[model samples]
Target: AQSVTQLDSHVSVSEGTPVLLRCNYSSSYSPSLFWYVQHPNKGLQLLLKYTSAATLVKGINGFEAEFKKSETSFHLTKPSAHMSDAAEYFCVVSDPRASGSARQLTFGSGTQLTVLP
Candidate 1:
């Protein structure tokens, strides 16, 4: 079984400042981790993913995350925040081997990012 935990339920940041969203995971086996962002009523978009290639993973919209197995963490960060970046973010875990009725993806509760002008 695998699970994802987003440390912050909400995070507020001023425009042009750095942004950070913390996340952790627990999995019995190696898992694929991802960060997804939902802008208001828009659908979720893939931000970044880690599948054991590089520890540091970069994504669209200037966002990035580093997978740290020792810390069990995959924290998302951006050097600067934008008004358009205000949205709800989700951390997800997936077992590539799972299939056919078996549970695959586990999503974190979610973290709402508020960008203040």
Candidate 2:
């Protein structure tokens, strides 16, 4: 099983600058990682996922993350911040041993991105 922790609870950035959201994870086996975004009062959307295939994963709206197994880190980043990017982001890991009763995703605390004009 694996679990994730988002290092930052909130990140404020100017609209034209870069954005970085840090995440760290621990797992007994190799785990599938994901980044999901949730706008206020809206459903969550998948940003990117790492399924033991690629080290670097690119997502919509110029976001990306690199999976570093040795470091146990999968951090999300973007070249620029936009107002639309202001949302809550979750770092998630798939629990490999999930059964009928167990939940599927182990989620991070979440990073709230605030884009300022």
Candidate 3:
């Protein structure tokens, strides 16, 4: 079984400041991890993903995350916050080839980011 836990339900940051959103996961297998963002009244867009390729993954909008096996963490970080960056973020865990499994992607509760001007 694979699961994602978003450490924060809400994260607020001032425009031009740094932003951090934490996430943790537990999986029976190596697992594939992903970060997705959803704007208000919009669909979820994939921000970044870690698929056993590299420990450090970079995403759009200057966002990046380092996959830490020791800590089982994949925290998202942005060099600076922007007004457009305010949105809901999700941490997802999925095993595309699990035995007898549907290969479903499980999503976290979601982290709402508020950017203050």
Off by over 4 Å in 1: 99-103
Poorest 10 consecutive residues by lDDT, candidate 1: 96-105
Off by over 4 Å in 2: 96-103
Which ten-residue region of model 3 has the weakest summed lDDT?
Answer: 95-104
In model 1, the Cα lDDT at residue 102 comes to: 83
lDDT of 1: 0.94
- Cα TM-score per model: 0.94, 0.92, 0.94
Instruction: Please write out the lDDT profile of model 2 over residues 34-100, one tens digit for every residue.
Output: 9999999999899999988889999988999999988999999999999999999999998555665
How much does candidate 3 score in TM-score? 0.94
Clashes of each: 0, 0, 0
Order of all candidates by TM-score, from best down to worst?
3, 1, 2
CA-lDDT, candidates in order: 0.94, 0.93, 0.93
Q: Compared with the true structure, what per-residue lDDT tens digits does model 1 show for residues 84-110?
A: 999999999998667758856799999
| CA deviation > 4 Å runs, candidate 3 | 99-101
Whole-model lDDT, candidate 3?
0.93
Least lDDT summed over 10 consecutive residues: which range in candidate 2?
94-103
